[model samples]
Target: MKIPIQLNQENLQEVGSRMPIPDYNREADNTGIVHIGVGGFHRAHQAYYLHQLRQLGEALDWGICGIGLREADAKLQDIFNKQDHLYTLMVKHSDGKIEPEVIGSIVDFKMGTKDPEPVIAQMAHANTRMVSLTITEGGYNFNPTTGEFNFDNPDIQHELKHPQDPKTVYGFLTAALKRRREAGLPAFTILVCDNIEHNGDMMRKMLGTFAEAQDPDLAKWIAQEVSFPNSMVDRITPVTTQTDIETLAQKYGVKDSWPVTCEPFIQWVIEDKFSNGRPDFEKVGVQFVPDVGPYEKMKLRLLNAGHSVLGLLGALHGHPTINACIEDEVFKNYLRAFLDKEATPILGNIEGIDLTDYKDSLLERFANPNIKDSVSRICAESSAKLPKFLIATIHENLAIGGSIKFATLVIAAWCYYSDKEADQNGQAVEIIDAMSTDLHQAAEQTKTDPLAFIRQESIFGNLIRNERFTKLYSEVVHKMYKDPNIKKYMRDMISIE
Candidate 1:
């Protein structure tokens, strides 16, 4: 057995010649970007891009200082402290190739679970020119139905009352911006890297509204001075399991407390707008476009929505991973039908993007055998995901008199998945959603009231009132109840479409 090399700055030389290690002087680099919600996707995507830039011996000033906002982030803080803020990124190719590299872009980390003062100070620091976030779809703290910031949230209220002891993302951001303005420094660009539609616009509106409530002058200044650039980020980074850690140690002989694993595919499209000067990300395959709307819409509707299409239905069919689901012909065909028939027609015309080739590439990415992206991971936040991914597609299709059959089936599958909380094989499937209780209750009501699931105004929202949608939805739900052969149903639906 090869001896394991503990990953840290002092042991960089020991890990040499096995996988590529950072050759740059990490200590000399400045933290030009401060990223919140330093999760797997963030590490695998943005941080990896910066690492690639640094590997080319450029963008040394654009090092990252990562901050974790929740109590769970303390685990990351511990790992980063032990590893000297260094970790391995093991990229798994479709053909069973594993390429590992030590990424040194995340030079420092701060945990803001207990006290927000240090995080705020770091963001307010003069060297920090950009504040990026991957706080997930729900972290924006907006009402899904109204599309407005939720000021009544306890954390938001606390931040409003006690700005000095802020906790939420908005709280820390607002405090840091206030400090920067008072110090006569320019505002940093707010780059939101979440999967939301028009992410930059959403961030500006939410933050500006919050700032306005606190101090109107500060809100006005933020609107005038700060630049919120919309971006579309894509990469399939699965949750790192214990087996992944063991594989890294046993196969690669590198002992890392926490390392990220992902597919070789990655893409980021950002609007060419920044308040302070930005990094030359364009040098490293990052697309800086004028309007990210077309790209953003295409992704949200097809790639993201396609995930939900497979996730909800796949889970019910007893599939464990995304690749497993996509490998099955029925599931794959269903996804293709949803993309080609339902999603593509509404996308209008996206310049520089072939919808056919893009959809085909999505299938190839999902079928990557080495990436064990769990169905549970994809189905975790249905309440937050459906609105942007699948539900919006259904809404638009209804408006344009297009097909909602595929999307309607997915909703029916979600209801069954939520109600039974078990697969067709009688194995218990975990339900993870903020609206789990309500979802389960509403789903359970489908036994008597077939319309109960769609009646949730916050989620389905008037879709139940549409005659065509309600009729289609009711038929699908009843069919699921009477016969739970999801694969057969999917095949039949494909034939119908």
Candidate 2:
């Protein structure tokens, strides 16, 4: 059956307020903040916040122009077309409660491959104040091993060779800024919403690297004029399913075909810097921090790392979803012990939030039954996520002689999980990380020398050289593989006793 084009809003069964689209009568001119990669996370998190601001009668000029780089996401395109650029945001809560919000932050959408002209025009528009990016970590064409711009990438090479019709996200951003500079438009803020450490600094570095490789003067200008505000954004939005669409229609009476589903928790912390103009995003729950470092570390290390640890391990242990993983007695204990003993002590000062309470809340959020977030999804870019989430935490713990065993267990779990040929149910598991080949090789070598097996630079990075962590992790992995009663081993490893 063809899904209805509109949500039957009257028949909605959820408990959240239907925010009447507020009077955005203050018709401000089209000032561009070209957002690259309008994915599920953007719709659920950043766009939802913008929708809130719009609802409260602010940020009239804070309009977003979305650009999709690849053409494979025809489903998203079709849904937008059917709804006239509208969709539903179904927020899943831990308490079996649901909040359905209508998000309207995205005003325009353009395909980079097909409709390059409009996308480029919007990017170069005189009033374009910022270029916000939600492109995945790999989207920047950064080297998987070094975390630097992958200059040799064919798309990047094409972009550098043809600046007028740039293809890559970094290229498109720089080319647009170059055009603005020629038009005497002041440089715009480059807001980065990726999970990289010092994301703003990374953006500037990547742009600088891209431009310097192309033109020295353009690189110099970007270094001086661009504002790359470090930010931390968090929300657990799963890939939307057909069930989501049916729920929207049957429960809420809304007819959105491409409704987004997400966990209730959301956070955005921005460094207070804007060149041309910026939305009063602060007015809509976005914390304006003087230094976002502490919070960034907290979120990446605690929340994100927590997700990574559970995700791969969950998949390997026969749990289908994150909710199911946490329900398992062993994983639950592992997570609780991890947050309390291994993860929390390494955390330094973060302004306004209590560590204990924060961690407690995070566990509750993880245990949210309504949100069927899968372990495989969070494990998508474990290669990239591990550095930002796990490795740094390990470093901090090792430096202080703090307990890192539970954290090590998480890493060990990932190693075992990654090595597995089939999923828990005997289905073929897709290993998506760049280090998959090396990891598989190492996993096979584990029978001979577990420590030596993990020394692969492709996955473990330099941390494998640290004899102490390597030994501990190897011992844990050995125990896990050797144990006859795997559930007992998991429980014993996680137990404080």
Candidate 3:
């Protein structure tokens, strides 16, 4: 039996030449980016870009200092502490090839759950030019439908009452920015790396709202001095399983306690705006655009919406993973039709992108067998996802007289999935959402009141008011409840105008 070498700074040479480790020195004093919510996606996407840049012997000072706000992040902090913040990124290609590389961009990690002081201090540091976030869709503490910041959030309320000891992301940010301003240092640019439309703008609004409540002067300073650049980030990073960890140790002879596995394809498009200096990411294939609106819209509508369509429908049909759903001819065809007929038409001319090619590529990416992207993972946060991904498309199409038949069916499927909480095969389908209880209750009322699910005004938001949409949604819900032939329904809906 081959002894697995522990992944750390000291054992870098012992890991052998097969896996690529950081060639350049990772110095703590050179940390320029303080990123919050250091989860799988951020590591695989943003940090990977920096790793590539560092490999070219550029942006050596741009090392990332990852922050974990929740108590659950203690595990990550422990792993990073042991490995010297080094972790493996196993890239799984569609054809069953796996490339393992140790990424050294994250030089340090701070746990804010126990004490927010160090995290706050790191962000306030003059060397820290930017603070990026991948806190997921629901992390921003905002109403998805209304586009309003949720001040009623307990964390936000606590932070407002006691700003000295921070709780939420906004609290940490406000505290850091306040410290920076008080010390006569420039504010760090807030770069949002989440999968929301106009993420940067949204961050600015939420932070500004929080800051304004804390102190009007600080709010004005943040508004004038800080820069929030909107960005569109894409990469299919599935949750790492134990099998992945064991494979790394057994095959590559490297034991990574918490490694990130993702698909080969990755893309980052950002608006070229920053309060402070930034790394030369343009050289690393990061698209620096004048406006990320078109790109963001295209991605949110197609790639993300497509994922939701497959996820909700796939869950209903008892498909375990994304690739499994794609393997089904009906599911594949349904996704294609939705993209080509519904999602694509509503997306106006996206500069330098062929919609046809992009849509085709999405199917190929989704069908990657090695990734094993779970239906449950994709379905985890439907309440947050559907509003931005699918419903937004439906809203736009409704205004423009475009076909929403495909998108409507996905929502209807979601209602079914939520209500049944069991797949067609009688397997208990886990309904994981912030509003799961509410969703289940609303969906259960579909028997007597077909419009109950859509009537969640906070989520559906006047979606129930649209007579055409309600009619379509009601008919689909009733049909689904009667006969849960998901694929058959998909086939019938594919040809609908």
Candidate 4:
């Protein structure tokens, strides 16, 4: 089957057999939201949801104008621009079923590499009522353990120097909000859709700090007027590959320049607080509540924490994708035992969710064959991820006097995997981290001294002081060096429960 033409709005109607398209009356809709980090997850999740709203003739004005701040984003910006800010979202089912749709929630895109002025201008527009972000875990510019904005980062330093022609999101946002304050316009609802715990509050803190450094008056006004609502979001969207683009054209008969692939599951739970009005997201499957704290903790423990357990071990074992790790009985059992014994006892309850059911569903999603979620993807930014996803959980378990076997094992795996001197199957280990050079140097020292890695008080805090965690973590790392048969070692460990 051949697509009649390329996947632009003009040709959306030609691909009806594949699935529906946003062929709605979208010409009059204004851009009410400017989303930063318009990557695969954004396209597969939030943008997809907004596209659904447009399909139902609701909240048409809440369209997204995508913004990309990094040099890497320029290529994506070009692809999105060529496709008229439209792309195909292919839902990959484990049972070998594919559901495809041409999503059109994004009406425009701006790359900060070209010029930050236009992107800031879009945010300053009165019609833009909100600015949503999916800037990943590290983009927040904060030290995970200290929970302080890393103002010393080179990017932040540059942003501080040139506030007007800002390059970082913090710089652009400060400039935009400053304009709004001067013009006597109401501040936009700062909706942060990232995965970190208390993401909205984190954004408000970091962004506000940036503003305060620039203008104290603007910071005060923002603190008084702006609303930052915490939210919980879940989706298994993977990085787009060339195969995804080809598959869409060959199998689905739609030529999408950049297509997102993911499992057919998504969720968004938001706190019910927004200044200057907001959309009724509850009208379309969103959960609006007075508080999203309990819900956030539930996701952080089960989903995010579970990913850390799977990711480090899988990458160290040289499993290319997460599904391969899940296929191993030992790996699957490890996930189940860790969640059931180590994670769940402390997770407690969310009002509407069944804890057992949610855990089972999460394991199933991890094993979803269609996702092809790479362990490296999760393993990236370990310098930042471990503190939030694993260390905090470890500390929580420690404080509550709960079991930490699996959590300790996760730490051991990270310590071993992060080593610059180690190799996975004769191939040099690839360490992707914000502090890669520094982390690798420190990790290299641990190749001989197991406790050397965690001694970085900034990363592990005083967990090194705890005799219990130290003895277990050291023993595991030592065994990793002594035993060459990793497979049997994993089996024996996971057999504990």
How displaced is residue 377 in candidate 1, in Å? 0.6
Candidate 2 regions exceeding 4 Å error are 1-31, 143-147, 423-427, 483-486
Q: Cα lDDT of model 1 overall?
A: 0.92
For model 3, residues 103-209, the per-residue Cα lDDT tens digits are: 99999999998888999999999999999999989888999889998988888889999998889999999999999999999999999998899999999999999
Task: Give the per-residue lDDT digits (tens) of candidate 1, residues 1-497.
Answer: 66789999999988875789988868724899999999999999999999988889898788999999999999999999999999999999899899999999999999888878889999999999999999989899998778988988998998888887888888898899999999999999999999999999999999989998887888988999999999999999999989889988999889998999999989999999999998888889999999999999999999999999999999999999999988999999999999998999889998899889999999999999999899999999899999999998899999999999999999999999999999877789999998999999999999999999989887877798899999999999999999888998898988876
Collision count for each candidate, in order? 0, 15, 0, 0
TM-score of each: 0.98, 0.91, 0.99, 0.96
Let me know the TM-score candidate 3 reaches against the reference structure.
Answer: 0.99
User: Using alpha carbons, what is the TM-score of model 4?
Assistant: 0.96
Off by over 4 Å in 1: none
Off by over 4 Å in 4: 420-424
Per-residue lDDT tens digits for candidate 4, residues 227-291, read 99999998998888888888888877788788889899899999988877777677778888888
Where's the lowest-lDDT run of ten residues in candidate 3?
488-497
Residue pairs with backbone overlap in model 3: none
